[model samples]
Target: MANYRLVSFKTCPWVQRAAIVLREKKIPFEFQHIEPDNRPDWFRAISPHNKVPVLRIDDRISLFESASIAEYLDETHAPRLHPEDPVERAINRAWIEYMPTFVDLTSGHAYVDSEAEFEKAVAAVPGAFAKLETAIEARKGGPFFNGARYSLVDAAYAPFLQRHLFLERIRKIGQIDRFPRVKAWAVALSERPSTHSFPPAEFEAMYRASVKKRNKWISQFVTEKAAAE
Candidate 1:
């Protein structure tokens, strides 16, 4: 049996982050891909919340949040993903929190047909990116997030950053050129061998399929509502 098993979906940024950390640590495990629309009963059994990135270790199941999982793995595994220093580890944690806040408030809700909402999200990006840019500049030592070493912070943020860059092309939201440090950091991180393991083309196909399905559902809903009226 595989020492670890991860139930996850490729398109979910959270799951992607966990996968990245596992790869970076050179941890061997089994990956079971779950579909967003149709989550399996076994996954729900492992994770009561039915969330992806549920990791099974020696018959112990864990769930609810990717950051925690990454931290857990870092603590357990051979290579440390966070700084040894307590203060630096806290700083790394802060960055992890920061990435998700921006992602949830801005990027996550940004994808819609509304031009106004999209513009609002676009505006928020600069401020969010600015904060990260300053953080990276002030820290100043890394090709990664926290100096020369790759930390849990980088693992936490890499997947979201990758999606941000990918969406720029698919959504036509413009490159992240304004945030030079972040852009550079993302490029370096994406080139890592682990990143290649999470196939981008497959994720994109899944996303497109989701869009089509959602549109069809909406159309049917509207038609049924009109007929009832």
Candidate 2:
């Protein structure tokens, strides 16, 4: 195995995806955590994009971007995470690439400034889930996106799905309840050893604390609602 070092920020969804793929592949890697606000000169020197999820394969080759890191990991390691057939593999890759939309849709609900906004965001959430419901419904018997065989699509979405834990408690949204298949899928992915890897226990606590100061509107809204309930 080539020397591997992954630059990540705990709880960064994009970085979590890369970390999940590394763990799932059973590839030993050095996990280097860096704060985005205070990146060192050496890190910025290597990363033109200045983002987490930069995987250092060696001194000569450093890769940034989650998808590229994942694809590289899948290609280089054994027990391939992507599908074998060309079309099916492409389909899986399409969903893997589509993960950002999942983050966007969930954010609309998770970080609202007011009750009206929360309601509006919550109302819109089903529409998002409805689309995923269609896709997941098509593939029955799945505790995973790819059924028995866990794939890169699962890794891509696991971070997004893991947010359900925080959203359910903080937002009081019955999002997972609305979509049975997706709910089951999230639970399965989260339970997988690799899904729980990377970010430590305090990561979520730290996230909530940071966001509270960052967005007081959301902090007030969620706090009031949480108190009422």
Candidate 3:
């Protein structure tokens, strides 16, 4: 087994991607959560890209980018989180690559600069999810992106799904209402142990305060945040 240390920010969805993979694979790893503004000098020196989700392996090598880290964990560990067949693996990789789009669509409502911008952002999302709903209708099974087996694709989507669920609670955008498969996937991912595992007690409060600080749309549309489910 390799020694693993992950450097991360508390609320980064990207970092959560790697964390989910690590936990799902049952890798014994150390995780350091740093506030963005308070990142350590040593961490900065070692992380060439200066980003969160840097996975330090054996104190000798540091892997930056959440995608790279997740792939490394999946490749090196047992209980593979990806499909075995080459074509299926390629398909899953394509879906995993789409995670960032999910982030942008799901996160815009809370951080857009103006009401019009917020409306535009949220407007683009339903069409995007409609596409996903179509894709997901073809999924063979349930409770995860890959059905019965939890894969890297599920880990990739889980964090953003949680974010959207949070948004649903705050300001009922009904983002997933029209898409039953997408809604069911989101609900299942939200319940996974890895999804709810990280984040400090102050995560929700801090996230809201930060967004409300920067975006009036958040404050106007958001009510008191419910506790994490």
Tens-digit lDDT string for candidate 3 (3-36):
9888888778888889899899888988888878
Among these predictions, the greatest lDDT belongs to 3
The residue pairs that clash in candidate 2, if any, are none
RMSD in Å for candidate 2, one decimal? 2.8
Deviation in Å, model 3, residue 111 alpha carbon: 1.9
Residue-level error in angstroms, candidate 3, position 174: 0.7
lDDT of 1 by residue, 182-202 (tens): 888887776666765546556
Write the number of the candidate with greater TM-score, choosing between 2 and 3: 3
Q: Residue-wise lDDT of candidate 2 within 31-114, one digit each (tens)?
A: 889987899998998888988878998767889999998999899898799989999899888876667876777767556667
Q: What is candidate 1's TM-score against the reference?
A: 0.84
User: Where does candidate 1 stray beyond 4 Å?
Assistant: 105-109, 202-229
Per-candidate TM-score against the hidden true structure: 0.84, 0.90, 0.91
Candidate 2 yields a Cα-based lDDT of 0.77
Name model 2 segments beyond 4 Å from true: 198-200, 221-229
166 in model 3: Cα distance from truth in Å? 0.6
Ordering by TM-score = 3, 2, 1
